[model samples]
Target: MGDEQIDAAALQSWLRAFARSVAEHKATLTALDAEIGDADHGANMDRGMTAVVAELDATEPGTTPAALLKKAGMTLVRTVGGASGPLYGTLFLRMAPAAGTADSVDAGTFAKALGAGVEGVVARGKAELEDKTMIDALTPAVEALEAGLAAGDSLQEALRAASAAADAGRDATIPLVARKGRASYLGERSIGHQDPGATSAALLVAAAASTLGVVVGG
Candidate 1:
């Protein structure tokens, strides 16, 4: 079996779906954040994604995956505020060069890029598992993607596995005590609430499954 390639259109669709998901769940994210940190995750992400879409619309990076992802990363870094801006921005930034200039990217390449992106986030945030942060969801999702690939799954199947793992990681955050970021400030108070960042990370994974995987699967 060979790597599953996704074209520029597929990448665009993935970004669009993620933006839409963030917008649609803005209130929910904010409410979740309010439980342990500042109640602005939703607003920040919504604004950031809106800006990213607008940037993409105006620039239209065309078929170059590296160009598109780099532009997206820069836009996020410039437009988005808070920890998400840097973390998500770093994700795309690291992924951009990793994706190279291919007209389309294979599943293995995509997973490698995603892994690099997660590493970027970890470097920037200095977060670890059970930290009640986005890393909680992202780490498991990446692991699932790798496991799926090792099992000879296609890109769609791998993404599906990743999404499920991300969801599970998000759910698992509910009972965890905060150990990083703003959530850590709450101490025992953060135990019962789900981490907003983890929830949003799951949304991003789900977006990939809904858009990228669906396109590949179809």
Candidate 2:
């Protein structure tokens, strides 16, 4: 997939897909939040994405991948509060460097760039997989992308694998006791509840797969 093949339209479409998915699942996301954080992750993310959609429409940032991501990052930082704000902000900020001026990225480049974003989250939050955080879902998704690429899979196939891995990772968090973030404060109480971050992270990956036309597994 050359740069010409993946244009600004595709990037904007991805963002729109993400915003729509999150908004559609706001109640479910909030329910997950009720088990962990301030029970506002869904509402906060919805608010932030709503602003992003508005910005995209108002600015019409066509074909400028870096600028679009930067705009999205700034919106999240301003609209979302608590850990999600800074963490997600950093993810998109780091991703902007990789996206550069391209209209769309190829499979390998997109996977590597996404890995960079996930690494930023790990560094910013100091969380690891199975720590009952978003890391669990995101890490597996990145790894799956890398693996798919190594096997010479198509971008859509790779993303489908990534989304499935993310879902599995999210489910795996159910029985684990939280070892990081506010959920950690619950001690054993966190054992029965799914991590909100992990749930949202899975949704993020699912959004990616959907936007890219990947046939994600159940």
Q: List residue ranges in candidate 2 displaced over 4 A.
A: 1-5, 213-218
RMSD of each: 1.5, 3.3
Q: Candidate 1: which pairs clash?
A: none
The candidate scoring highest on lDDT is: 1
Q: List the residue pairs that clash in candidate 2.
A: 6-104
- Candidate 1: which stretches are off by over 4 Å? 61-63, 215-218
Global CA lDDT computed for model 2: 0.81
Give per-residue CA lDDT, model 2, range 1-218, as digits (tens). 21123445655777888889889989998898887767888898888888888988877645476777788888988989788887887777778888767666666667777888899999999998789998999999999988987887777778889999999999999999999888788898888888888888898898888776443461
All models: lDDT? 0.89, 0.81
TM agreement with the true structure for every prediction: 0.95, 0.92
- Summarize candidate 1's per-residue lDDT along 124-188 as a digit string, tens digits: 99999998899999999999998898889877888998999999999999999999888888899
* Candidate with the greatest TM-score versus the true structure: 1
